[model samples]
Target: MAYLLSSERPAVAAASRNPLLAILRWAAKLRAERHQRLAFREMLEFDEARLEDLGLTRNDVLEAMGASAPQAGLHLQRRRALRSAIWLGRSSF
Candidate 1:
């Protein structure tokens, strides 16, 4: 493990205890989560033909949004990958 010099240690400790820094970090997290939700909303707006072009159904989007984590896009990607794997397995038969 890397050890911080005494001077650097004090600065790091002070930063961690800073209330403003904590709030800023919290606000940034909220903003990032909001952006993720907005992106999903935009995806939901796409018509069936457009969604089909993207290789995803409206149900896929809904399922992704239903995930407890804020990363709906990650869920969608996982779902798409699972579907692709299933299709590939069927084709190999």
Candidate 2:
């Protein structure tokens, strides 16, 4: 019997040594990505009028979905409030 011992190996090799850990990591990543994709899909369900009401355009939603930014929701909420204020002002005229 012959054995090759190496003191240094790639991190991937270490991960391969523990298949369970690698599988768990992969599953966690997949779940996170799935949730993100679902969020985008739900955004896509909104019609143009609904998006306008939310003070968001299709492009805004698309950009938000493409970029993983936690502030996107906050930005959209601000826009919605601004639009609501503008609409109220116009109604008062």
Estimate every model's Cα lDDT from 0 to 1. 0.77, 0.72
Best by lDDT: 1
The estimated TM-scores of all candidates read 0.65, 0.48
lDDT of 1 by residue, 1-93 (tens): 687776566456556577898999989988887787787789999999988767688998888878855567787887667667666685331
Query: What TM-score, to 2 decimals, does candidate 1 have?
Result: 0.65
- The sequence of per-residue lDDT tens digits that candidate 2 reaches over residues 30-80 is 898778778767988999998886777777767776665456666566656
Q: Evaluate model 1: give its lDDT.
A: 0.77
Give the Cα error of residue 51 in candidate 2, in Å.
Answer: 1.8
